[model samples]
Target: MMTVDYRTLFADVHRRPGSYGLDGSYGQAVAFIMGCDAGNAWGLLVGFPEWLAMKAGGGANLVWSALVLRIAFPGPTVVTAAETLDQQHDEHAVGALFGLLDEFLADRKGSRGAAAIVSSYLDWQRLRREQNS
Candidate 1:
């Protein structure tokens, strides 16, 4: 599996809208999709159904949610990346996202699955960004 650079993912997601099945102008579409994903993650964390959660129920939900929130509201909705080395204390959104990843890894008893999940997210983020960009 390959590693994912989240910064690149954000740039992609920020740039692409059509590739994600969104309509409207590029910015509008990307923003809409970003909000939808973020809302779904938020919903999952708050006890929404697994199906509705969109990868929110499992251990990876935390990471998924963090990325969603980051896309939806960038630049200090929580602790900006510059603020903390340890992801746990950055911001609520970031914590929720990584929290899911952590939980998933812990439940599985290792970082193997966590790495895959991260990789997949990175790939998806990159693809979306490229399509839109």
Candidate 2:
């Protein structure tokens, strides 16, 4: 099995998503990332949604992609799912997704390492569970 470095790949994708046939759309970029995660046997995105939720002030119900969308388009607007999807294809939302992803990756590479981040996420999850209980 070949090891894939997703951090570098994400940075490259952010730099030139068109090179990866992404059409500069957040939806397409997310789909591409989903494909990559699906191919990785290790489930690289296992706790990413929780991490994103922590960052974006979202709850467990929202996935990482939704968190990205919320961060990009913070204003609440009444729109159908299709309308929202269309709107998310804009450059602003795509930029936010990749930019946030870069930040997330950087945190994972911080001094304490990915394990520390995971520990923080676990602590957050415990707190949320306690609050719900």
Candidate 3:
């Protein structure tokens, strides 16, 4: 079994997007991260989406990538779903994505209340699961 140090991986991706086939495309970067999360067996990045949504003042309706994109380019920049998709590949958005991701990882590293946020997100997930069951 292999473990992923997502913070280091994100840094690598940010440093050389071309090596990852991202080509400096925000959409592709988002896709790559999402794929990594999906395949993560060690539970790394757990509660990240919830944390991001909370940070972005968004609900769970939008995914983590959408939350990042929204935070990076708010208002009319992503007013509609169509426009949101269009901006996903924007160069500016790509820069913002990596910057925000760095912030996110730093928060995870040692920021005050980082555990509280993840704990709160876990509680939310537990409540949702209980409600559904």
lDDT (Cα, tens digit) per residue for candidate 3, span 49-113 = 77777666555677677777777667755521224555444766667777777777667766535
Query: What is the lDDT of every predicted structure here?
Result: 0.40, 0.72, 0.69
lDDT of 1 by residue, 54-75 (tens): 3532223443334434432445
Worst 10 residues of 3 by lDDT: 79-88
Which one is best on TM-score? 2
Clashing pairs in 3: none
Candidate 3 or 2, higher lDDT: 2
Global fold similarity of model 1 (TM-score): 0.24
Q: 1-133, model 2: which lDDT tens digit per residue?
A: 7766788898889889889987767778888888887887637666577677777665557767777777676667521122366653467777877788777767766674557766877888889789999
The predicted structure with the larger TM-score, 2 or 3, is 2
lDDT of 2 at 60: 55
* Stretches of model 3 off by over 4 angstroms after superposition: 1-4, 76-89, 111-115, 120-133
When summed lDDT is taken over every stretch of 10 residues in candidate 2, the lowest stretch is 78-87
For model 1, the stretches where C-alpha displacement exceeds 4 angstroms are: 1-78, 81-101, 106-112
lDDT of residue 22 for candidate 1: 45
